[model samples]
Target: MKSISSADKLEDQKFNALRLRQLTETNPSIRAEFGESGDNVAMLIDAISRADALSKSQHIWYIDMIEKRYDDLAENEIDDIDTSDKDLKRLHDDLRENLIATITSVSIHSDNIKKSIAETPDAVQLLVNAMHYRGREELRTTAVVAIRTLCSLDSNKILFAKAEKIFKYLTRMFDFRDGLVLKAAFGTILSLWSFLDDTESNSVFTIEPSVKAHVIKGIIKLIEARCFLDDVLEFLARLSIHDDATEKMVMYDATTCLFYVLRKNPSLHTKENCAVILHAICCKKDHRTLIEMRSEEKSRRTLSRLVEGGTPRAIIKVNGILERLKE
Candidate 1:
């Protein structure tokens, strides 16, 4: 018997065709047999190698058949089968090379396949490793996007905790003057926030005070660059709703950052622009006194805009501030 080593040879096109046929066969025994044993490292390498050939020729038909078969199994089983066996791990490691290749392949045109590869449990780490392995800027960008998509699928606890190195790489992208990289960085932050919200597991995977401050600093740099101030301001305003004091402090820093932006270019902090910040500060009654203590011209303008707008919360805030001002 051939040893199932990590360096197993990839299967040929003919073998892939046979495997596809076996995988799609309607016979229950054959389907089970393929499901149990066909998904090994060597086979996956083979499948990836032949993906283009099969896809262009007969791969699409086989994929359709396999999808239908899996759908049927899912409907009946109602539980995800455990594919975390040792063999699967080895296969995932082997498939990492193929995934990176496809990501860099100029000819590959299937977003679904990319997404499927990203959905794998270990895929984010694999992509991160590929980022280090390939020094090409385009490949690094692709890896970051792929990792972000994968992390978006789960909580920040699992994704951020396990993928710190990738997070660092992503943060560095913000330093580049490229708009696309900046956009990707924004997406990665949003994904991290989404993960925090969805999991509710507060062990500080990525939204910790330090990380939050780092992100706020990056947004400030972007504002200084005069790149995307309004969007950044809105994001900060939205983030203020979180209950964490550290997060709230980051929001305060964001507010201060915006104030500097407004001082330099007052037009950006229009009445409409400051409403969300006003709402955020006034969410807690005590915060109104704090807002009044700032005593900056823009803060007063923001408070006045809130008052004129007649938002009940804003009205209360103005009342509190006015009483304090009177004293």
Candidate 2:
């Protein structure tokens, strides 16, 4: 009998890694065996760690695997891919999605799992990179959802792991027109901002004026598409207070669209945010003409109805806009 060499053992491990990826996805029993809900989390993390070691990249193994295959297939540009290639692609997607699902599930389960995930070499970084990669909306959504959960505890460990990259990745998330991903992106960014220490918060998000315009306009595009996320409106209410951001908001007609949603969405959260944004733009003298022409003239009846119907904050903001229109 020939002795097994280290190379043989390595190949065996890699082979098992690939097989493990599929088994957990295709077999319900295996998936449950590795799920986060019970005692299997430790083994699950170990499996992911082994897979990441095999990948030997900044991203998770399955993501790297599928993206490479996708790149190869995309380059060919053939009308029909070979059957083997399609099967392999499906296998990679299943593994990638299931592993990401595990990561997301484990993130929300327990503080211990959160800490363990963070402790896993490059786990948090890989999750962030998954969001950064292009053309995979579901991948981005799941990874960011996990990030939101991990960051919920506000552990400096997670934030400090390539924190600048994480910030940039999330800012890019706003540019995605897919409303579902954008909504998840908004909630994730809110989590980061809600807890970031002042120094990091100021530094990480302080983009150039053009970049700020791009982000604001991106959100406006979503409103035009009628995505109308309350988190987005809430974010805008906070951000538009800054003079330059408010300027971009006016340039992009955010005030009018916000009013459109305000009249349309009866949710108190929506009402207050729209009121706040309209009021902020109203406060700026340079843009009041734009506000008057674009939003106020169209807003009085809606604002009047809101004055009698909304929360105190919304009412105050509505009254302020009406008072401006009067003057």
Candidate 3:
């Protein structure tokens, strides 16, 4: 009897999970049963957990194989398989990315599945690895979507918040040239905020002044491009509550950008958030003076009129901005 290797076990788990995902997605009965039955959910979670462990062990094995291959090269010796280091690297990447597919698939948009996945740090580690895989954009994007879905669950917010390195990867995600990937990436970065009520989850950009500033600048650029205006405006609104974040927004001329958002026929919510961000930035005398001098004439007039009418939230924020503009 031959002992099965970790790589074989990993492939088996990945196959099982991917198969289950296909059946659940394509069969309504199976999907319903999987969603309703704790047993089915448990089975899926177990498969994912086992896969996580096996993949980690296989990563170690692959590394050892590479080192051995390097030694063999030194002796002018070759493996029977005739594989190169590049070939082995590609094989490992394919295996790992396929595992990411299995993960995203098996969840099937179930919160319970997402919660279970989020609770398992080992499972989360797989997605984190994909996020760090710079060579493949789609893999990193899928990992970001999975992370965004997991973080959407309030129960998992603290779990993600605890992984401070995830924030760094997320910040790097903005560098991608693909518009849709960039959108999902930055949106996921902002989605961590719904955990505000939890003590352990509240840090949201608490580390690294450079990271915080970059995020501010990115949001401003996205807003200037008129992509995801409402959401980015809201992000700046919440973010500017801190002096440090507001300082970056000011340095980047975000106040001018927020005022430009007024020309876009924004919703009341957008108007409120836009006003809120401006209000935050205007709290300082130099900042207020800057907005006063730098603001466009027509947009400033449009905002001034908002002091009289709009949603109560919008009116309040508008009032605050107008009052500060005087100082």
Model 1 agreement with the true structure over 116-156: per-residue lDDT tens digits: 44434554555565455323465556555555544544433
Better lDDT candidate (1, 3): 3
Q: Per-residue error at 134 for model 3, in Å?
A: 1.0
Candidate lDDT (C-alpha), each = 0.49, 0.62, 0.64
- Residue 242 lDDT (model 2): 78
Quote model 2's TM-score.
0.63
Question: Candidate 1, after superposition: displacement of residue 185 in Å?
Answer: 1.3
Q: By TM-score, how accurate is candidate 1?
A: 0.49
lDDT string, candidate 2, 1-327, tens digits:
011112245344344445554565466665544553433554444544443344334235445656676666664553344454454444433444456666655455466667666666666776777676553577677677777767666563335334546656776777677766776666665665545434455575344566567567766776766665676788788887779989888788776687678667559988888888888887775545545534545745777877888999999987887777766
Best candidate, TM-score:
3
Candidate structures ordered by lDDT, highest first: 3, 2, 1
Candidate 3 regions with alpha-carbon error over 4 angstroms: 1-89, 109-112, 175-183, 197-215, 287-295, 298-302, 305-327
Q: Candidate 1: which stretches are off by over 4 Å?
A: 1-101, 104-116, 119-122, 129-139, 148-162, 165-168, 201-207, 243-252, 261-295, 298-327
- lDDT: worst 10-residue window of model 1: 1-10
TM-score of each model, in listed order: 0.49, 0.63, 0.67
Residue lDDT tens for model 3, 175-227: 77778777777777776644542342444424457667867877777787787
Candidate 2: the clashing residue pairs are: none
Q: Once all C-alphas are superposed, what RMSD does model 2 give against the true structure?
A: 7.4
| Clashes in predicted model 3 | 0
